[model samples]
Target: MNRFNWTYIDHKNERHHVGLMHGAQSGNLLVYCNTDILIIDFQVLHSHTYSFFIEEEFCELSIEKTADEQYLYSFDLNTEADTPLNRYRKKLSKKHLWQSLAFLAGFLILVFSLTISFTYWNKYNNQHQFAYGNGIQGRETIAQISIDPESEGKLVSYYFVANGKSYRANTKFKENATPFFKHGMPLIAGDEFVVKYAIDDPTINEIDYNRPSRKQISTYRNRAIERHLAFHPELDLDYCSCVADIAFKMKGINGLADLYFQRVSEEENPKHNINSYKRLVRSPKFTQRVEEKCWAQ
Candidate 1:
């Protein structure tokens, strides 16, 4: 059986709240539950003899999962009664990297299956080009900032014009792929020119490096960025703060933490499988603030 102690330490070391989570690495972590209440368990896949202990009652825990993996589980303890957090957590899904894309991939699956599913789900009947998506067009390489140098780019906001629109997807360097890569020593600012965004949905998002020793496409990619000059270049560089420009040019969700189903009432859920009560009581993100935010009295 997996074993560990969740301990609270008031060590005379520092001040900030520190959460030390030690668990065995294995098949995947599970929100193990009984019939009574929801309970979380950190499944140890990698090592042997795992141990962690906690004082407070924690109903939630996080786990890692790769693509194409589904979790299967069953209740072990005498499930039933008013188990509260323990029972609820069982209904929650393990935190899947498939869900977070945790590790960065330069040439990622750019678009996931869900991204397409949702897009069409809304256009089932009236598939006509109805200026759909709150910022769906934001997918096609809206901006590409060369981190070494500084620049600014523009992407028009159509918020009032449409809802459910997704903005530019912030991607990363892929681990398996040679991947298009760049870095900004100076912080990238909202006003910085990244990419001019020439084409519409479904465009060539490329770059050039000019390294004959490495890849021939480097030169082409470099030239492409060179030619991607912004039409009305903003008066800003990578590190400058345009704070407002950011929300306008980014995707909506990041990971499971954002998965807390707060207002999925109008989320266009085609599955209809969305459980209202499960999301309400089981979600780790749903931990009440009034009880959570207060200091130990």
Candidate 2:
């Protein structure tokens, strides 16, 4: 339940106090203008607008549901007839609306320009090794290759050791141009690859996938299973292994890695990863396969 209060000055130079009480879960609403009860509806499950009269002035009260399942209450006074005050308020409202839209458009354009400039700058820095000739060649291991479910983009995480310190970084590419696909071979975890980084700031680096690793895939599936269980401690090892095996067979190692570690924050949406995993495990094909392979007595 939440309560909101505000003050309104009417055309008659009279001051009125407006108030609203809303029950978020119970779907109840109550509106007040001054000492008078304007609207009372105990079954407001959705957004609605109410029309009424305050003295000779027409008024409208709107109740809207927001994205986070909260209610927003708004009141507009003397909007129906073209009275002097109504016309003035209409002009003022239009002025404010236009000002707000203009501000938003300008802000978005500025952001777009900054983003484009920064992207080009970063690309140039990486290409030219920050304009410093102190860049040294380093070997980075393929820690993980994750595929985004929505965009089908590949994110590759790798790490390199410099001056006895390990630095981890990730890069993104479209599904077609993944760095993991090299010389008609799909690279996996534990395979070492080539990268170039600045000697002063090793973090400023880029992948050089033209030089592929000689090492083969090693324990990639096992590592994915371990990571999945680490993230979802509520699940048993047996269940995790079962799901990992099924996902690998169905979608291969990249899909399995994405399912296990696609970087969803637990603090943001605690149940997001588990909920997606549950949906997959509950699917008919997954359920049948798990029962046949994992649950066999």
Candidate 3:
């Protein structure tokens, strides 16, 4: 207050309070004069710097003299000599940088997550799931074995011939096992049984293990698919079916449409299953020649 008695106020006047560094004091406060206020310096303390509001007829007030450059360093409380606002500016700068970096990282992770989800989701939704061939086709043979009179023909230990190989599958049914047997028995020795297996893991062959029930066949086939895929990690059901068809043809099936399922264990032969299919591509007719000179003795 220049006139300590009265401080000036005008109609076109406004003030900005910058800091109140008075530690717990009620009346002590610091204010920043707006630059819009055309304040005039009371004396040639240096050049025009800042002026306080005086309420008198505008009497001049005296201040210490200093060089012009020194005046830039220090000023009356009305000038920009406050410290807290500068600290606030610095904090705002740091906050802005942190927010920007966080946004960038979150955006990149979102993009990657969407890309991965889309890829797997597409695979799951659009997977090839068609079962090839309407049914089994092949030659028929009557593999006969003596059965208990009460058990009927289902007791016959059957031998099925497929892919130029005769498979002796146990179809012997007992009177005690009859109720379940007649329903689940393979057509006997040398009888062409219709079987389906994953061409991926040919060892997972299914040949009417529980006959007259298609449900069992599907259940076992699904299990086989899971087990084969666990080890193979390649060759899905569609691929396996195609390969099985090729192997069936290579071994010279009697009927292309109705060959029986022969649950044969996959041996290390690697000559008649999916491996053989792959081998055939690498070296043509290898499977054909082996089959032509076949001996499943």
Per-residue accuracy of model 1 over 1-24 as CA lDDT, tens digit each: 233333223223322221323333
**Consecutive 10-residue window with the lowest summed lDDT within model 1:** 248-257
Instruction: Write the number of the candidate with greater lDDT, choosing between 1 and 2.
Output: 2
Ranking by lDDT: 2, 3, 1
After superposition, the stretches of candidate 2 with alpha carbons farther than 4 Å from their true spots are 1-86, 93-97, 108-112, 123-125, 128-155, 163-166, 169-185, 210-297
Q: Write down the lDDT that model 3 would get.
A: 0.38
How do all models score by TM-score? Answer: 0.14, 0.31, 0.24
Report how far residue 24 has shifted in candidate 1, in Å. 99
Give the poorly placed runs of model 1, Cα more than 4 Å off.
Answer: 1-203, 206-267, 271-281, 288-290, 294-297
Error of 3 at 97 (Å): 2.0
By TM-score, the candidates rank as 2, 3, 1
Q: What's the CA RMSD for each of the models?
A: 37.9, 28.5, 22.2
Error of 3 at 169 (Å): 34
Q: Tell me the number of clashing residue pairs for each predicted model.
A: 51, 0, 22
